[model samples]
Target: MNVRWHNGPMRLLAPLRSGATYRGWVWLILGGALMMPFMLVGAIVYNWFHPEAGFEGALHPAVFAAVIPLTAAVSLLLPDREVERTAARRLLGAEFASPADDGTWNSRWRTGCWFTLHAVVGGALSGVTLGLVPFCAYLLIQGARAVLDMAPTGAYVGWLPDWGLLTGPGLLLALVYLVAAAAAGMRALAPGLLGQGAADRLAASRAETARLAARNRIARELHDSVGHALSVVVVQSEAASRLIEADPVFAARAMAAVGETARGALAELDAVIGALREDRDDARGPQKDLADLASLAAESGVEVDLRVTGDLASVGRLTSREAYRIVQEALTNVLRHADEPRASVLVDAGEEVAVAVASPAARRPRPRPGGRGLIGIAERAAVLGGTAEADWTAPTAAAPGTWTVRVALPKGTA
Candidate 1:
């Protein structure tokens, strides 16, 4: 490995001051601690079977070997990989793509392997840390006595050969480096064993795409159904208020139309919400198709000259529904933004279904850019392998001219 150090001694000793180093140490320490109960039980059982071997036998390699499989089994079977991942992310600083737990055999096996590695390595490092500190202290004391020509105080120091004063500091420095290396190794291993794999990432991506698609579908439904109803209501209510006294019969008819439009909008809204709740598979009633275009124009509360040609019944259900929505959105745009609330609609069902709506453009102000209704029309057509375009026609400096929307969709088999 090519290592880069910027500040020499300070850079070399940076891990000692870092909070991540201590947190990593705590994570390893917890792993060793978790294995203690199993090891203790194994030791107790070993002592019971062989009383002649005594307590010293409990510390034998056999006791540790038995506990390893037990810890591995527990880690594998427990449905707590999420918990492990959380701890690893917070304490050991492992970066995971997703925190969701995918209960797969491969995931469990990886968790088991990680558990084994953690327990074994942690226990060994803990033992080394415990032994090295006091040993380094002893070496420091003994080296100081030799350098000062002072007598050694402890009997344990009498057997060792005299060494220079630098031995203690050298060994202490080695211990620091050892701890830093162990922490680095644990961090490096965590992401692979505990983090999300290829399959998990792919699954997450597919789910996100599905969610976005559903949301877009709901938006289009609301914009078409509710928007058209509200536009009709606004126009009828305004007309009813104006003619209520002079033309009682006509005003009553307009008010009735307003009431009918509101009820229809409410029903459509309920269906949309019911489908969102997944209360029933058929919560949403049968979708509107191209056959409903005449009724839509009649109830639009505007003078709409609608023309239809060719065989409408031959259009497929999917294409018909999209074509209907495209027309509905176009009429809604005319009702809301046109200077005159009158439009001409044409539906040509030939090799491909063609729909067009034209109306006098608003003269006082132009429609804002990036309106959702127009975008939705284009999207609906594009989804059915079709095209949609809207622009001003016959414009001049004095007049804004006619605003027209045109859409064409492939006529699939019924």
Candidate 2:
């Protein structure tokens, strides 16, 4: 009997040791509390219409049952799924892909179902707790009196027969398990009701893809425009510093070139930033194209032997713009990594537009494989259904091997 008694209480009170049990109780209590206002309004409305029923009659079980459907309908129509999802996540430990309102019929009905289930189950459990808890307290007191060998007062005993002392503990244990099961059911249903549907998932995926593409485009713009400008500024400033004392006129020209390059870079930087900010009305000048290659070469701070074989006006705007960026990035690499800053640029516009930039290979260590400039060139070419290649040429008797970047883009009729 002693062994059985000890193990019995341990098993009965085990759920009290778990924090989840307390959280579950709180969740149910909240659901019950939320239902009260709806119940009150329903009772008031029913009493207002039927004066003979009076307040007491209006507060009937039927009125409370009617509020369950009212709650479900309200939950379905409201655009507050985010609020409900957050509550479930924090209280019930539900996992949802996103808490944003999906605005779909599928999600709406699920939320409505969950809301109705919560109200009904919570109301039932709460009603049971109010009666069962106090009765259990009375039973505990009576059991204590019996253990002490004290005679039960008539008021305390009333019309109740003496059951076993374990009755109170057993009832409390059953209540705990009941509450736990209800909580588990609610939690299991939360994700399906509150989580993203297939359409929501697809939209999220597309948004992510667009975000990444925008970021890459911005990176390429900064790399091709600002990167090339910085490279030119570095070379021109250095030349000015070396020639300032010996050849003042040439030094002045170099300094002037630096200023022009800086201003142009600042403009391009503004344009890219404006684009990022989505400032549609900001009239940043149009992007450079193959027609602007001559001006680009002139400001590159390097001697570029530029050759054009066909009319650039015939090239579509997209192809021309991308071709310009590819050449600009190639020239920028030449200035940054080549042994000699001088390079040869070739642009041939035909059924396909071809661009090539060649410079002496660097005597120093080459840049790490897949540099951003090279990658940008390749990405641009691929976007137009074209191809790009960067490789080292065989050394000749007159010159060491040259690093060459070549790109070809389709000449779309734009």
Candidate 3:
């Protein structure tokens, strides 16, 4: 372990937990500054009681001191409760090592209790050094009385060891405090941290499993179920248009049926999106696959010419989603920047999936230093475990020169 060396006395001092929350600071300050008077008053009252030894005879304010910790304890305690832990799990997007289906309300409650105890102990220890010192009050009085020889503290100058008698105890308390604060800080942030180490693997698994399930579900909804209905509606609409030229009654009926069909599909799409938005504790995932790309393209009102020659089902969801994202971002760029009326998206699936989005020449192209857009494309591809290229000019004169983004990712990104 490489211990950092700081020059001077700061090395002897304890470090505060760097990640303390806004609420944590509020509790600390209020407990220290606002509650500080009690410690001063207790030292004063204790001296009055002891009379002879004066200020040194003072002890801590046990009552007020107890409340300072107790209040902080209660606040920190509630945040780590079973209910709160569940919320934390969802918010932080981390998984704890408990049996998913086996977890009970009591299980989280028990964890919360442990967390609260540790947090309160830590918070209270921190409050002690900051609040109980009475160092600030002593300084103000001493500074005010420094010019007067008759000052009560003037005759008290004597030989002392190592920055006075407070060093050992003060340092010991500080060490205890730092340990407590670190523990509490870890407890507060642990769920998020625990999963970070293995997030990529977890995500790959979830995406593979979730995507297959989502794709199958969406396919069933879109293909045999919704697709068949839409086909019938289209057929009926075309038939109605012909009927209108023949019989007025039949034309009106067909157009009404087409409208009803479209309205029903829209409602069903909303229901699907809603189900996905639900908070599920056991949310493995609803996976996305390349199979959904066709529907996605259609839904976006972007004209697509899809030609898939190989088994797309063999590829994993993680790879598929990354490919999808590449396509999505490319299309978004065209829509936002290209201002082109039409764009072409091409997908070549084999051992790897290659996705390319080509946009028409910008009427007044945005100033790009390296023949542009290529750098951003390459960076995004690298993140998704792939390579990319962009060109402002076409490879052959047969094809019009335009901006193009092409990316390739591994097929087994599970």
Candidate 4:
């Protein structure tokens, strides 16, 4: 029971035993020693201006305030500022995820304030720590006197109180209090002066948001391009296998189509991977726009009728690229799930660039949880101030029931 009780309490003091705590104590003492000369200089200058007043004269509080700014300015403007900042983080164990630099006006002012406070408090604590040495020596002498049965005379020990409540236990308690208070004061001040500023945090968050968006776009592109290629290869390979015994020429053409589709897929996949490699070097490659839709439709291994009604030169790059992906994903869905492997693509690039893909509906579409293809199409359109919709249309006298995916995208860079 005793061992278990002591274990919990011992963990609380673990920080005090670390090397960082020892380094902090060293920096505290050194900062105090360095600031003492500035204090002496301020005192000398004050005395020079007031010839009549000696050291006995009481100094005004404003005089001390004036000296503080002077020393603080010197500390902040000099290259020692970096040393102090690094020491505060590496030695004093400042707890901030991302600390801002001391370059801006506000950061400089805060840094000056930190230096001023540290110098004053550390200097006072240094004196108290040094003073304990003499206090211990005096107690030792008094103990020796008691052992020898010789009373302490006025010559060796100057005017002092008897060793009792006033000098013995009371002095030890005061020492403990002083040390604990100084440690607590430093621990409280480090975070406020050393942590990141508001602007730095905002900039970091924006960068993270941009990174996530880039990764999401890459995933959508992979899905549309690679998924379409796989569906074509599967359909063509099965058709070739069934016809190889009946028609040799038709089977050869099917095999050739599969090879062509595989090569196109490899090229698109390589482009995506190359873009990822470029990201590391801080460069971005071009995206597949609506102009590439012709080649995509040709390689889909199905009957496709594509038509464009308006001028596509005025469409924005993002809207054009997203529109192409929407068409590609729509055709991929039809090939994978529909019975008739025939589709039509109509692109009307006017004030708003609109794209539509329709095919004969054989089965009702079932919604699946966490489907990225259709959801990606919707998200891409939404990002460009556009909208995407998928539905089943009633059969007309000229055509059977149809499944359609339609998207409308704004033109400008809004």
- The candidate with the higher lDDT, 3 or 4, is 4
lDDT of 1 by residue, 1-414 (tens): 134444676787788788887787777777777767777888888888887877754467788788888888877886666776787789878776543565787788887788877787776666566677787778778878887888877756653414635766677677666666776787787777877766777888999999888889888899899989999999999999999999999999999999989998998898889867866756567888999988888888878999999999999989998998888888888888888889999999999999989898654335587679888998998888899998777768886678889999999879
Candidate with top TM-score is 4
RMSD of each: 5.8, 5.9, 15.0, 4.4
Model 2 agreement with the true structure over 118-178: per-residue lDDT tens digits? 7778777876887788887778777777778787754557423144267777788889999
Report model 4's TM-score to 2 decimal places.
0.80
lDDT of 4 at 195: 56
TM-score per prediction, in order, is 0.76, 0.78, 0.34, 0.80
Candidate 1 similarity to native, TM-score:
0.76
**Residue-level lDDT for 142 in candidate 4:** 70
Candidate 1 regions exceeding 4 Å error are 1-14, 17-19, 30-87, 93-109, 116-120, 143-149, 153-177, 362-370, 395-401
- Model 4 Cα displacement at 72 (Å)? 2.1
lDDT at 270, model 3: 52
Q: Write model 4 residue lDDT over 214-333, tens digit each, in one string.
A: 888778878888888898999989999999999989889888989998987887888778767654523434567888888878878768999987877788877777788888888888
lDDT of each: 0.81, 0.83, 0.53, 0.73
The order of the candidates by TM-score, greatest first, is 4, 2, 1, 3
Which ranges of candidate 3 are over 4 A from the true structure? 1-278, 281-287, 362-364, 367-380, 394-398
